[model samples]
Target chain A: MSIGLKKARAVIRATLSKGREMGLSPLSVVVLDPGGHVVAFEREDGAAPGRFAIAHGKAFGAVMLGMPGSAQMARAEGQAYFMGAMNGLFGGQVVPVPGGVLMRDGRGRLAGAVGVTGDTSENDAEAAVAGVEAAKLVAEA
Target chain B: MSIGLKKARAVIRATLSKGREMGLSPLSVVVLDPGGHVVAFEREDGAAPGRFAIAHGKAFGAVMLGMPGSAQMARAEGQAYFMGAMNGLFGGQVVPVPGGVLMRDGRGRLAGAVGVTGDTSENDAEAAVAGVEAAKLVAEA
Candidate 1:
């Protein structure tokens, strides 16, 4: 019922492969289970050193809030202080960006999340969506 | 070459399975690539709430220092101030304990690290070593 390791790796592989095919910068992708613990992760060959942590933060944020990163951004728009406090409390694990997407199971229950980092936020989000679809799950972004 | 997501997940699964067989507490495991980036992670169903971060910190500490967590503990034995400074600088990501083990490639080159939590330090380290060996890698601890 949950997003297990096999599916998480599928999502990561799909996201990175799509990034390569689209000529985007090398990427780092992270998958997090519903409890915000890492499930699987990968950093493409040429990804920047910082991309791994960023991707993890984005995915953790999505899973922790039970929403897509884009929605978290929207919710933080007028509550900068609250968002900042939350980030501080979690040791800066929350990333308000478009790269994080919530994944749902066949029954529409929140399963986990995927986060991609390397290029623009929009591109990252696109890759995350592709990853979700590749894993045969629904992406809520 | 690098510790890919597949190998990382393999290590985690091996470790958790062993833990269950040994009747240890539910565990959280983490694998990190040479660059100190997460490769894969898992938290067992009944693992304590704080185990995820502790597992990650232990693995990250091993990779960042290029040594086993026990070695880091030894080095920090008489350098409390220095270790404290390092922890402060890295936002407390370093965990000096026996649960972290450095991984080596076939050629004995440093590859990454595996860390396990939710049991006694010795038991955690034992699990990590078993995990690394299960993945057909070397555990230098």
Candidate 2:
């Protein structure tokens, strides 16, 4: 029921495909297991190294908190100090942004998460959802 | 020239392909740029999460030291304290093991490095060389 390697790679491929279809800039995509460990990751040709960290942070934060990126962003706005502390606790892997999407399996159990970077927050979120859905998993963005 | 996404992904694909052909264990591969930044990474299905960190550390250590993993291992044997200090300096990203291979361009300039994990050290090094060579880059192992 976790995010297996096949699904993780599929999510990365689909995310990049959707980004190309939408004409978004090169992107970095990261898939993390429920434990906030990287399952798979890729950075597009033009994507910078920092993009990977951001994408990973977003996904790690969402997965660790059991909340979607949007909710994390909202919470961050109201509790900036708490968010900062959490980031420190996790070695700065908490990015409260809209690009992180939690995944659910057939029975609504948590699978993992996908994070996208390289476009605006909203665009990144859109691509993340597209990728998770393409892999036959529900995206809670 | 730096490691581009095309070559990076090719390296990972070829590495996994070679591992499969050799009947090796599932592997995690990491490609790091000359500057010690990640360009691409993938952990095969069933591979433990720690494999990614180990692979990354190997490649990062090789690239940062401007030496192949074999050389690093040899040096570590003779200078364990120095190696330990280097590991601490780099946040434990220095894994002096044979699975890390430095990549070189046609002109003999450093392109990047590849790290492989999930098998015996010799088998991992073999796969790393196979992958870098398959991508038309030279492997310095």
Candidate 3:
């Protein structure tokens, strides 16, 4: 309930628009409550297979770790060793795409997350960010 | 709980011990409840920054979909669709890693998940499997 379903849908709409604006191909986007539960998601046509999942996967990595996927690269030698262990844990459901949104309530506690995949990681991230702005949620600063 | 902390830890310890036994570098491991919450986690001395979270993210994807990351490759065509829809269902906590463990209770109920990243994805998965087997839990058929 951090961001209402109405807003969640709006974010998706905005994300799609952003994807179009960026000239990225089809994309997948997801929004999650702060506790990291799904609230809404959308996958546009023509995205790569696993593209949607990877976006969600990367976003999961970002939101749960409380940062962005780009930043995770610096956490170690990079995401290989780090990513390897994670694959073992979840049985290999981790995709490293960028572009996810974290939602906060009006009071500004972390409320949920949004992740998008398809196109470059950075482009995907831009779409998610645009969605968050449309929803009026701030990233945890 | 599919793999309780006690068992999960045993799996982690054994996995790590095996890694050292095999001359693999230090690894980070995470076990998540069926619902994809952290049950137990271990970060070896050299784990890269945020590697642990990434592993968890991918593993989350595997557990949510009941498939291996490799399986996702087959479904890449539908991947965008999956991600778009699933991220919201999982609240943005799942990732589609290449290899991870799916913790299941007897009688085929999902208990939780295990993700490891450090060595190779296959090696990380092998270690997780060893841990799950050590914990006396059954993998899905």
DockQ of 3: 0.06
Instruction: Give the TM-score of each candidate.
Output: 0.75, 0.97, 0.48
Q: Show how many residue pairs clash in every candidate, following the order shown.
A: 0, 0, 55
| Over 4 Å off, model 2 | none
Off by over 4 Å in 3: A76-79, A105-107, B1-141
**Candidate 3 lDDT by residue in tens digits, A6-106:** 88798889889988988888988887655555778788877767765676776666555555555555542343444444333444444544565456667
Candidates' DockQ values? 0.29, 0.71, 0.06
* Candidate 2 global lDDT: 0.91
TM-score of chain B of each: 0.94, 0.97, 0.81
lDDT (10s digit) by residue, model 1, range B1-141:
678766887898899888978889988888888888776677676566577689988888888877788887887897878767867877799888889889998899877888899999889999888889999999986
- Pick the winner on DockQ between candidates 1 and 2: 2
| lDDT per residue (tens digit) for residues B1-141 in model 3 | 556778878878987887787777668888878877788888887454456765676577777788755554345334544553454466544445454677777777887777777776677777777777777776431
Give the share of true interchain contacts found in each model: 0.24, 0.58, 0.04
Descending-TM-score candidate ranking: 2, 1, 3
| Per-residue lDDT of model 1, residues A29-134, tens digit only | 8888888767666776556668768998898888877778898888789788887887898889999889999999889998888889999999999999999999
Tell me the deviation in Å of residue A4 in model 1. 4.7
lDDT of candidate 3? 0.67
What tens-digit string does per-residue lDDT give for candidate 2 at B1-141? 788988998999999999999999999999988888888888888888788799999999998888888998898899999889989989999999899999999999899999999999889999999999999999998
